[model samples]
Target: MGPSVMKKGLLLIALVVGGGCALFLYAAATRGLSAREAPSAAEAYATRTFRRWAVPANARLLRNPVPPNPETLRHGMEHWADHCATCHANDGSGKTTIGTNLYPKAPDMREKETQSLTDGELYYIIRNGVRMTGMPAWGNPEDGENDHETWTLVLFIRHLPQLGEEEKHLMSTLNPKTPSEIEEERQEEEFLSGKDLSKHKSTNGRKQ
Candidate 1:
């Protein structure tokens, strides 16, 4: 085959393969993509492939302006506890209820699949988020603060496997508390102070 003819044939094959994949994905979506069910091996591979290709080349090459220092990591740790720990957990092991239930599920950042990604790719994903996934676009273009925070988060992600017990404990304290947890703490404090629990119980009963 002539060079031009061979090129045309290759393009045709590429188009056919792409269309077939798209149709397959559409069928899967229509069949009800369940968060509880793990994705098939093929589906998982395709998703990862698409994500890698989706990031722009320039973005992938961009360097992290924020230095990965102790202070930056500390800030990242605090931010992760307050904002990300609900889903990603303090250890970056997406094992929390929300993370586990997400369609396609959150990834364990400490794993090779995540750690192998380029620094810029990680930053881009954090800022823009992956489509058709539970991850949200957390970085705000209008807010420079968000950019700095996200860069720090990337550093913290790199430190996940090396996270210490003390750091986890600090993060646990910083994590947002549910209303029930807050009330439980209050009651515990009152009990420790020898305050009457009967009055609190009667007040709650009246509200109910």
Candidate 2:
């Protein structure tokens, strides 16, 4: 074969290979993009990765002066209902309206994996929002370095497993009546009277 013909054949092969590679990557990207609206394997992986690792760091470094007061829990619950309930759901089931449209899908907090997460870890996730996941960082940039509100939220979320159906309704829609929930609300009103809810723990390892 002529040298010119040989060179042309090699160039053609290279073009085909490149095109194939590009197609594969494009498919993967598009698949992930679509999954954000409806959950796919990729979205599950993203949630797992964030819960396993990302959350811990955010709480330890970003969330400082963690408050252990019961009022903190009450405040957190109120904030959650207003800001997070749309996606996380009232039952801690994590059934957001936007979630139905995602391909990767959001998580259901009522499930064991989410319920088992530590308060500190949950705080970090709330403060620093997971990448590529629907979760957002509600951290306060100015006070985040010493924020403790994030931990308050963690405390409330950790109790998801123990809440009854009635409690879930009130907690999600701003009407909880359980003594503890009621007390939490009262405290929330008192503590949050002059405070904000947009601001922020580290929980690692399975207790069991």
- The TM-score obtained by model 1 is 0.78
In model 2, the Cα lDDT at residue 2 comes to 100
TM-score of each: 0.78, 0.60
Q: Which residues of candidate 1, in runs, are more than 4 Å off? A: 1-32, 143-146, 198-208
lDDT of 2 by residue, 13-70 (tens): 9999999999989987776434444545785677677557645454544433456455
Q: lDDT, candidate 2, residue 49?
A: 70
Q: Which prediction has the highest TM-score against the true structure?
A: 1
Q: RMSD for all candidates, in order, please.
A: 9.5, 14.8
Model 1 gets an lDDT of 0.89
Kindly report which residue pairs in candidate 1 clash with one another: none
Q: What lDDT does each candidate get?
A: 0.89, 0.65
On residues 61-155, what C-alpha lDDT tens digit does candidate 1 reach at each position?
87888998899999999999999999998899999999999888888989999999988999889888888898888867775333889999999
